[model samples]
Target: ASQQFKENLTLVATHEKKLELKRSACPKPGPGQALVHVRATGVCGSDVHFWQHAGLGPWKITDCTALGHESGGEVVAVGEGVTNVSVGDRVAIEPGVPCGKATCNFCLTGQYNLCPTVDFYSVPPKDGTLTRYHVHPAGWLHKVPKSMKWAEIALLEPLSVCLSATLRAELKLGQPVLITGAGPIGVVQLLCAKASGCSPIVITDLSSERLDFAKKLVPSVNTYQVDTKKDAKTAAREIVDVFTNAADMGVQVMPEVTMECTGVESSIHTAAYATQSAGLVFIVGVGKDFIQVPFMELSVRQITVSHLFRYSNTWPRAIRLVAGGVIDLLPIVTKTFPLEQADEAVRHSADRTKFSVKTLIVDGEE
Candidate 1:
């Protein structure tokens, strides 16, 4: 097959106002690669950030770039040396492709999320899967069950992120947990934690609408609506007191594990203060390069802090968990649009008042 496919809609950056949809040709797969018929591509927060800010952390956008990474599709063609999947097989593409060389410590340990040679899709100069068709390495594709919905399958990438963070926290069964930020990633973390056997999960967010949506997915969860402009430490103390039953135990706070999902600096500090002594604080949110952390308090409390990037060695487990009904991802997708309306979908994702948790661009729908 030739790479001269039709011009499809793609979000491009030019250090200007925002991402603009441009017409582009379908890219061909190289060795060990497969051409995927894009079915559903998710609009992530990072995608919005890249569109507005033109970069994330140290990664900058110097050229026109397609911005989407959470996606799923069917295999339309395979390059030479590809053996895992054939044409017509439904698969979820892991957007990050790392150099699988043995010399790389991250690859050797199967923790390729840390691999420096990783080429992540949707970042600068890397065309994402938002177009009609995309080509990716077969090694990064995971076959989806026929019974799974494309929208749910598209979520495997973000779920892998939550799984990685939860794994780093080393959560135990029946342990109380608190998650800051009730956004898509935060809700996904709640689901992953529940699947991992954590109990009494509590989540905090600024919007009551998001908290309401979260309640529908996790009915038994304890949620608190926070004022983003207020002092997070005071709010965190109040929440911790309520969870710890300070009225009975006289303890200041509780929760064995705290998963900070909001990249906001205040939320990070709040999570640190809210965590129990000798507990773990997993920073799942991607914040600025540096922030003032309460190291002295953490030292006295013996709190362990861990950070997360995208994900690695987690897709198989996440797939199995979602397949086994341990985690229901259907609720995460709040809206869907056709590929022609790709720009609208991205705009909806950028506006939180639209009550959009996850917006997927559907290329083909009956």
Candidate 2:
């Protein structure tokens, strides 16, 4: 292991969403670690968020750091005791590395995503997978078929998220479901729900273009163009009339579960109104520190609300679903760029005037 292996080209995020490509010293794999030759990485909303704020929540990007989590790569080298993956293994990178201590109850209970000390990539200050070479715990890398394209494999991370939300929300066969927001997460949720045999799947978005994109991706998913000008109560009535509600006043039907992908307060309120009594409203979107909620209404109906921090034990299922042909995410990918153009790729993905579902940065053949 020479100290002069090679300098890695890394994408670093700074204040005010500025991104710079810099040469970083590539380090050797330590015990139980794998030095990955990153093939592709997806730019996520959170990536843009971190770039804009120089950090997220309480974590500030003082020193700056690379920011990516959705990643797929090839193992170029493995360290001692790394048995599951070896050199040349193509894999998806699970960015959250929990402090695998047995003393932690969350890890023991298979909810490692909740581990207090989990080090998630791109969460400000932590070097992420947005580089040509990255060293990650071997256990966090899941082997994928070589047949899977690099971007497709990288998408397994977000797919894992939607799958986790689906499982927790109890989406099942022939159940009506409502999803708020038509962003990439919403589209992926639609796919996961459609595969779960959810009946009359529905999605809403403020932008008609995004809603249309969701329907194009999944023809069965019904779409609603949200009127942002309308108040939450009026929006709720419209949504209810469109998705559920029978002719009889006494026999009104509503979605059994609601996926609130937009953290907008009004959208959350609409979700509360559109769901059936005793139903669950699952939130996966990051919003303000505190937004007003319709607690009285939810309390009266006994509707339970929950949230997703990240995902755990979902990569294997995500792999099985995509690899076994349950769903194809290639369409959701709007574009790809070579690693050299990562800055441009991220900017394009974040541009509102420009339309893009997902943009990927891939390591081109040297």
Candidate 3:
């Protein structure tokens, strides 16, 4: 059915640090776009980050815009030139769409994620898919296996980030890897690392409860609780000590790869220190504009550092892993809310005491 002139319920970020559900006009599909019946939308850290501060990094909410990007649903209608997917197809929304112009260097080279002109959902000017009906680029919609649940499809965006981190780190099989932060990203990284055959993986976080929960989520993962009071160097030394003794040869050693999922400056420093010489440090977290790095130590050790921006061509692999049961995505979701409670859902996502690892807003059931 045509969404034109149809009234729908949408969650909007109106005013300073406020989220409210409002009635809005449903969007109709234009050329190369499809109208989707948004079934599930996962609230992300960025969404909370935006709502808490009413902005993120360089982007601020100037106008009333919906807040949600990690989403998937059924295509109810397709516009002209849209043939990849059809009505009634269950699909995962990629969220970020670059200017697919021929002159755009980033898009032409298949590095669309790097395109400066990209319009990402829920990031300032672009309205997100928090409503019952939304129109999105047809190419950005990926059909999921029918067996995949709505929640899993919605979470594909974050899973893509985890896959990008794993790929950028160039994780080697059987190599010891260190991960900092047990938040959703860190937990997902743990899964990706294990799936890549990384052995003796170590994860750290400030919350002992989160660390314990990480172990419960992935029984094989070795978790450590970081002492926030201690300096990064001392914490790094202590973490390395555990690895030194756990080495196969019982010789002093450090992890070959370190994925810093926490944006804390201390965690970044600790990751650099815990990684062995000639190893790799993957900075998967976003932080301040500039961070102090131990350049001398990194240079002396010849450690390679890399960072990932969203993801590049990772959805297929992420989908297969989840659909094939190679990775269990459901465990990451700790709470679910209806669309009407989006404001509460965002608040719960930011409050650690609420025990919400991930919060989802189902389109209906309010």
Candidate 4:
């Protein structure tokens, strides 16, 4: 009976085209795993990228792949040897399942985000949880507070990313921070920064609509709308001017901590340029295989450049932050759609004009 009623939406590819939402039977949890009846799954930017671009960077989607990672739901059943949680526990799923072998440097260091054997959900060749029911490792499920909504719980994944970035930069209270790209992750970083007591948070983006949304989410964040279509040099010059002027007024400009959330080369360069001498620059965005860094300037200024992969050891902190009312998630959820309308939801997420910050695929109504 469990196998008979299980249904899932899969991404299938054809000779000439690709199709998403082709349904199939649900899966059972293997050993040390749990089957979750998905209540809410957020449509992430990476999900949209998979739906449209068919892959992310080097990972290719050659076969049917489910498309969701940001999700929260109730545990329905657990496999043998599981004791951390049980049926009916509300949870926020951490999407990455890393190999915990002690031999691996990443695992040994507790930086499992960089584990070589990491299998991330919603990534190509790996089925994700954009369905009625899904299975995940028991250890990756983080219990959520009773007062938190499924929508807010779904944000834990993105929040983890921001937390990792902040942690990497050693973000401190009352420190000025500059974030590039006010997209979903960028805006979430702004929220996390504010909640962590970082002051004078500033964000820049190409879309006025997105910048407006960012303002709505965190009014205290100073925002700038730049024309991305302009030449990279011109754009960088304008940003430099803005930073210099802000610095002149004794306002914290050229932030001590810079979170580069946009993968665009120009934005990365701008972020590097905008950082203060000897400041920390945390690169959170995934870009091309090779990027041209301003080595001369970087060396001259002695800036600290750090990179981020998927988050590690951050789910619990993210959940607590949202549960404790330190970060408000309601403003970031710009739209919602039923599970059956997942296709439309993905399309809306890809369209910036729709003001889509984070779209939710609702599997429950009540």
Candidate 5:
């Protein structure tokens, strides 16, 4: 069972905006590393963004980089000092690893997501796990339950994100919350909020179709379709009404917490405007370089605006949530393609008309 790989087909994204399968030498695990037989990699919007733009923020593609971050695999080999995972262990890969330096304040304090030297997978310059085989830190490989499907395991990455955000929000039982955006993250956030016992959760999105999917995921969620033609204030007032109408919603004036997952300018404005005074708005989505915020209103209302940078110490809980049957992620995986068609997978993910919540590229049908 410890057979080494001679070579593997790697899906590569070039600076010139080309995707092709390149013959790559299988990488061997070094000390504290594990060689993973990648079973499946889920496509994120960022993956599609990088494949189309060849860069994101400060990270630009100077050479070909494999594009995929959400992946789960089986360990094929373990290097020296590797003990967390063994040969043939089914595991989910936590794609980001920060420089484990005591001198760094963020890493030392366990907020490694903010570590300046963090290496994030599929974020340009760093090769990701879209290939059949990948080498990852042993400590980052979380052993998932055998009952979890390979593609479903890949979903742990996104689920961890929502879980981490919800934890940061410090959700109180029966508290009303607002989740802006019905994309993959928003729906998962709904699940996390529900698990935390959040009541009368309200979600807003521009597309009725995406909101419909979220409604199906959580029928109790108050789905609000945003009219883009309306200004942020107008939409915000309507959202407030959804929660303040005591006759309709429970004893809540406005949502105590607002988790903005869209990263759009107006949606963010709506979140700020709609959240109750002294409430918290957790920014889960990455927005533009410069977004106009209502500084005066936020300052006056005493609303705390916090931005989430990936996750920290959430992989194990994420694994447990699914393995323990607290959540089921199979529904989020709407379409799957074989490894050879990774380009199509990314393309499929980018196409709004396709409207698939999550698309996966697997080593093969599994």
Candidate 6:
């Protein structure tokens, strides 16, 4: 209620590979919005990429803005018409809010993530929640139980992506699934597939440590490391062989679905080759803009390959999965840093050491 209370500290991405801590005016919640006192924010790969590359794909940072999207905090204030949340409620920020207009086909069809006018957090010119306070559409904020920690609540953002990918794959119980890459997304997909009753899920990566970490999370999950020196064609064949031979012993039974969480070209090829005919392949990772693949081969196999952007309408389910103990993300969070050390936090996240899985920037003790 005082002028001093209206100032917020923000971690701004000032330039390429640089972040500066500065004071910013706390934003006020407008109608249908809620002002959140951000408690913790996760350093995502995209956040690190934006800092290192200054942009992603065609989106470039046009201005100096805060740089975190996966965050959670308490609702401190609300605007008129906000009914779902109240002051003092803990919530996870969804980060993406579509242009609320009925004329848009994507929004009208319930696929708001595809809305061209959507403004996602930390995507170029947009300032993210890497601040002590933030304002967001109340509809995009999902409440969490008081017992949940802020870091865990913030992680729902990545989990939402995994859920979207799992949904797109049309995953079924007892179906075999293949996932490429042992990065955070791939690991999350592994957990989601396991919860969906997918049996004998296989994951591949370049790091044996990451693969071992995946196995630690789920002992039943099968992991393999890709040989970097091998030719792509040969590597793909070998990767596919593991999937086909997983359950039937030496019998060669293909997985019904493949979730390609690695943007690597070879991994994509392996995903296509490993899936059974009439199966689905979901490109879940963000990678190079263009890469050559065995399209004609996949065409003959009648496998469908699809790509998903950010999630839509998935926060509630993600929260349910974590709250119900169907998924545990705490193990994935390996490091934590305070707001003052935000720059170092992102840099650490960029490094894929044997122990680095997920990193968090906390506002305080949480």
Q: What is the lDDT of residue 333 in candidate 2?
A: 86
Residue range 105-202, candidate 1, lDDT tens digits: 99899889889989899876677778777889899999988877888788898899998888889888888899999999999998887877876788
TM-score of each: 0.93, 0.95, 0.96, 0.91, 0.96, 0.94
Spell out the clash pairs found in candidate 2. none
lDDT of 2 by residue, 1-366 (tens): 433355788888987568999886777899999999999999999888778788888988887789889999888899999999988899999999898898999988999999999999888657899999999999999999877888888999999899999999889998888899999999999999999998777899989889989989988787888887888778877777766642224555578899999888889999998888999999988789989899999999999999998799999899889988898988998988998889898889889999998999999651
**Candidate 5, residue 236: lDDT:** 90
Tens-place lDDT per residue, model 6, 113-207, is 99998999888668899888899999989999887888879999999999999898889998988898988899999999999999778888888
Clash total of candidate 5: 0
- Computed on alpha carbons, the lDDT of every model, listed in order, comes to 0.84, 0.88, 0.87, 0.80, 0.88, 0.85
Q: Give the distance in Å from residue 339's predicted Cα in candidate 3 to where it truly belongs.
A: 1.2
- Model 2: CA > 4 A from native: 1-7, 15-17, 245-251
lDDT of 3: 0.87
Q: Is candidate 1 or candidate 5 better by lDDT?
A: 5
Pairs that clash in candidate 3: none
Clashes of each: 0, 0, 0, 0, 0, 0
| Candidate 3, 1-366: lDDT as tens digits | 543445777888864778888886776799999989888999889888777787888888886778899898989899999999999899999989999899999999988999989999998899888888889999999999999999999988889999988987888788889999999899989989999999778899998878988899989888779988888789888888777665657677789999989988889888888889999889898899989988988999999988889987888888999999998888888899887787888888888667767789897532
Candidate 4 lDDT over 32-92, as tens digits, reads: 9998888888888887777677677777777667788888988888898889989889999
Name the regions of candidate 6 deviating beyond 4 angstroms.
1-7, 248-250, 352-354
Over 4 Å off in model 4, which ranges?
1-17, 229-252
Error of 2 at 250 (Å): 12
User: What TM-score number comes out for model 4?
Assistant: 0.91
